[model samples]
Target: MRVFIGYVSLSGNTEKMAVNIKNRMMAVGCEVYMERLDTVEVDTLKDFDLSFIGLYTWDQEELPYEANEFYEELVQADPQGVKVALFGAGDWSQPRPCGAIDIVSNKMKSCGFAVYDRVLKIDQEAPAPDRIRQCEDFADRALSWGSKRKKWRFFIWNRMQNNPKYQRTAYLLRRALDDYPIK
Candidate 1:
């Protein structure tokens, strides 16, 4: 199965997580493709079985603008059966929850994607060796979960507009896709 990992990094922490994910997956003999969220184009997706998104939260639980923007684009692109997992950089010093994984999980669930798991990382400065290994293990698990086929989205529009939480999020997402000015 083919897998792709996408990430957005500001202080390079998220990028490191992506690299570790790629390397670990490669070691396991899986075909992997990875790109930064900034370079990833929304139009040409659907080439893989699983897609992973990495980002950090900025304010509250909202995803970064770049990653969030890509997610919005995915909403209007016609649904596909892809398993997605989220990983992101966080810090032990902060009170904010893992920004990248949390937002990705919520958004993907809202949009009807089969989500496997969420990985959250604290900033590494003078790090413990076990922590690094844990990160690598998380990557391995993510790839394994990504290999599975997601639950099919039949009657996708009905599911999107009828689900309680998704109903509201999808409306706003539709507006974003159509360039409706946010009020």
Candidate 2:
């Protein structure tokens, strides 16, 4: 699988999680590409089979400046069947812990991308063994979802292109089926 990981980090917490995710994905024989969100080109998203986004929640549940900028660019682009998985690091005590994950996930869904259901959120300034394991698990789930999505890609894209009603219907169905209790 070809995977793209774009992230923004303040104080290195999110960056650490991004790196761990990159390493874990690479270990599993994926062709992985990693870059800061500020430096990534939104148009290149279509080239990847799977994409991972990492971000830190800013004050009051907002995405950091760079992530917000990327989100704006992302909103204007067609999803083109790229599946996205979100991960982040934040303090659990914060008023909105890892809120950026929700922001990005919602935006990706709105843009008609197949978003992975399980998001990886770490409550630490640095990764612990448990958190590292969580990253690996998240990568595994993402790969699994990507593989399954391949079988339906042509059908979904065809419906999305030829029928406007099917676009929303397909998204809603996928969202319902992918929804699961997060551990």
Candidate 3:
């Protein structure tokens, strides 16, 4: 499996989470690519079977300045059927903790990527052992969900293709399946 991890960390907190996720996925035999979001191209997302974005919520729950361009490009890009998992580190004492995660997750969904439901949100800077474990578990769940989704889509497509009456239904069903977040 191919995986892409894009992250923006001003304080190194989210970077630690991204690294943990990348290492876990790579250990599982996945071809993992990790880069800062500023250097990542939205067009390249289609090449990966799974992707993760790590970002911290800025003041007043805004996305960091570095992520604005990527977010805009993602909004403009066509749907590519890539599955994305979101993770981040933020101060729990803030009024809107990890707000960027919600923003990015919603955008990814609106742009037609299959999003994983289990988002990793760590409190503050340093990632403890438990947070690292959460990152690994998040990676595992994403791989498992992608594997099952692939099989399910293939089976449904093949069955529906053989019957012309169900072709349109199949298309709609596939879209719904892609849009739905995997648990």
Candidate 4:
């Protein structure tokens, strides 16, 4: 599957988690595009079949400026057919841990993306083995979801045309999805 991973990290914690997720995805043989929020072209999100969004929660659970900007662009974009997954790093000791996950997840849902079931959180640093295992499980689930005929119905097929990188099987599935009904 084609996957996009975008994240913002001030302390390097979020970036670390993002990398872990990317590596795990790669290990599973999924094609992945990873970028930092400061450098990523938000419009590119529409091109991927699945996306993993990561960020760090700032003081009072607010978004860092770069993350806030990306979040706004993501909200404005037409991401209806993409499957999304969220991960974040924050002070778990705080009353609320990784609030950015909730914020970003809600925004993505508002834009009509199908969010993955799990939202990963790190207390203050990169993932340990347990956390890495969580991401692996998420990767497995995402791969399975990407392959399902029912999940493809959400994609906007016209947008997928002309992409040579799309595998033949994926292309055919998208074509089929275009004709499939929502309900």
TM-score per candidate, chains pooled: 0.69, 0.78, 0.78, 0.75
Instruction: List model 2 lDDT by residue over 81-170, tens digit each.
Output: 888899998889988788888988998888888889889888965447877888888888887788655444553455464678777776
Residues 1-183, candidate 3, lDDT per residue (tens digit)? 788999999988899899999999887667899999999788788888788889998997899989999999987776667778899989898888999999988988888878888888899854479878988988888778876566645644676756789988877876787867332
lDDT of 4 by residue, 53-170 (tens): 8888988878888876777777577776777788888896888888878988888787787887678887884448866776677766766665556544333333244346656756
Give the per-residue lDDT digits (tens) of candidate 1, residues 24-125. Answer: 777655578998887876544477777777787676656777776787676666446767777777665657667556656776677777777555555645
lDDT of model 4 at position 51: 82
User: Per-model C-alpha lDDT, please?
Assistant: 0.68, 0.82, 0.83, 0.76
Model 2, runs deviating above 4 Å: 125-127, 148-183
User: What CA root-mean-square deviation does each model show from the true structure?
Assistant: 16.2, 12.4, 10.6, 7.7
Off by over 4 Å in 3: 125-127, 148-183
User: Which candidate number has the best lDDT?
Assistant: 3
lDDT of 2: 0.82
Candidate 2 lDDT at 152 equals 41
lDDT of 1 at 74: 65
List the pairs of residues colliding in candidate 1.
none
The candidate with the higher TM-score, 1 or 2, is 2
